[model samples]
Target: MRTLKFLLQKEFRQIFRDPSILRIIFVMPAIQLIILPLAADYEVKNIKLAVVDNNHSDYSRQLVSKITSSGYFQLQHFGSSYKEALQEVEQDKADLILEIPSQFSKDIVKENEASLLLSVNAINGVKANLGAAYLRSIIQDFNRELRLRWIQFPRFNPEMNIETPSSNWYNVHLNYKFFMVPGILVVLVTMVGAFLTSLNIVKEKEIGTIEQINVTPIHKYHFILGKLIPFWVLGLVVLGIGLGIARVVYGIVPVGSYLTIFCFAAVYLLAVLGLGLLISTYTASQQQAMLLSFFMMMIFILLGGLYTSIDSMPPWAQAITKVNPVAYFIEVMRMVVLKGSGLADIKYHLLTVLGFAVVLNSWAVLSYRKRA
Candidate 1:
């Protein structure tokens, strides 16, 4: 117990004395939490649109007005030439082009049908697909409006329309920040816990201080606990900072209890810190540990359902997420914050991460050598 206390004191003093470490622990998470949610938005907007108006008719003009007014698109170019509109797309000035045929209004009136051409810049597939879908929906609504205007109703009977209204659960405003902030927070916290711990032992080795520690009558478990506990506490501190930013900057408060968040975070940090300690045990230097940590972090975050849905991934990729600790934590954060999930709800995730903590920390302790 006395030996572990001394080790803890030394680790904390070492951490606080280094200005670079202090900046990384406090400053980096703050900036990333504020900036990442704003930039990592999934809702596509401000899609540039080009139009070729061959009919010059009221219906064609109304169609163009409806599309621009829908708020998803911007009118970048409006001219009478398809060739010019295509050139705008080629030059990257337009994301998509809307071409109305010369007989657009006449065909709709006389034949009750009309053809429209859409030329899309497929370089950005998501924007193009969403833009085309938005345009099509507006055009369909316009078609329905025209039909309603021209149709004659009998006095004895009236047409009845069925409407379906949708309610957005959890995120009433559909704010992307609500969805992204928690995940970004997890990533920042993970980076801190993993990268910092991974480099710890390696740095001591490089500075020739490790030899002094190894000569002492210290138990390996005590040494591991000393290294793990301080960073584990710091990891929770980082999580608190991120949650504060989430509340202050984005107005997001977790629907679930703060106790729940902290409890889960405590265990999650053990797993993450253990992974870092494992890396530290294997690597001989800080540079190698950093490169390896970055590589592993990339795999964890990318498959962890931060920016993309794990369900949408291929069967094999989805299988990979089951083993990923980051994926479980991100899912648990969203569940607790947005859905007001209880500890009972997250038992699966908690147990999975706890298992991770046990395996990783055991491996790190066993692999760490007092001599050699």
Candidate 2:
């Protein structure tokens, strides 16, 4: 107990004594929590739209007004011809192009149907899909209104015949920031654990202090714990900053117990720190440690569902993520913070993270060299 206390005190002093380390440990996380959530929104808005109004009638004018009023799209180009509109989209000046066919109003009045051509840039698949969906919704609403005004029911109402009720849970308005903040926190914590710790450890070796530690009477596990404890606390502090930003800036409240989330965070910290320790043990220089750590961090984060949903990933990728600690933590954090899931809901993820922590820490302890 005394040894552990002494080691803890020593680690704290070392962390606080270095200005760079102090800033990284205390200030960086807060900055990331505040800036990333606002910048990382997936809910695309103000998409540039080009319009080619060939009909030159009240119906085409109304359709253009409806599309512009939806607030999802911004009218950037008013092309006189379909070729011009297509050129705007091809040049990346517009995300969508609406080409109203010639005599559209007359066709609709005569045949009760008119074809409106919609051309969308599919480079960004998600944004293009959203744009298409918004266009479809606006057109559908217009068609419904036209049906109501033109076709009158004799006795029964058509509204009673078709009822499509929809409800959204957890995120009612589907705020993309709320979904992204937690995932960013996971990425930041992983970067700190893997990249920062590896560099810090290798720095000691480069400075010749590792040799000094090798001659000390302290046990190897105690030294390793001393090195890792500070980083573990730093990770939790980052988590706190992220949570605060979610509540204050993004207005996202964790629906589950904070303690439960912290429990998973603690386990994740152990696994990440253990991986860093393993990296430090193998590398002889800080540059090597940093490069290796960076390579591993990228692979882990990409596989960890930081930007995309793991369930949507290919089966092979999903299977690989099961062995990645970052994936487990990301899953648990999203579930607890966003879905309000309890331990029972994420027991399998927790167990997997626990196993990773055990294996990594065991490897770190065994691999750490105490002698020159």
Give the best candidate by TM-score. 1
Candidate 1 residue-wise lDDT at 158: 25
Q: Per-residue lDDT of 1-372 in model 1, one digit per residue for the tens? A: 888999999999999999999899989999989988888878889999999999999999999999999999999999999999999999999999999999999999989889999988989999988888988899999998887676667632226555799999999989888999999999999999999999998998999998998999998999899999999999999899889889999999999998898999999999999999999999999999999999999999999999899999999999999889999999999999999999999999999999999999999999999989
**Model 2 Cα lDDT, one tens digit per residue, 1-372:** 578779889778877888988777657877887887777777789989999988889888888899899999999899678888888888899999888888898887888888988889999998999999999899999887776666657754656557689988877878787678888888888887777778766878898888887887888788888888888998888788778777887787889989888888988899999899889988999889989999888888899988888889999999988788988888888889878999899888888888888898888889888875
lDDT, candidates in the order shown = 0.93, 0.85
- lDDT at 69, model 2: 95
Q: How many residue pairs of model 2 clash at the backbone?
A: 0
**lDDT of candidate 2 at residue 153, scale 0 to 100:** 72
Question: Which segments of candidate 2 are over 4 A away from where they belong?
Answer: 152-161
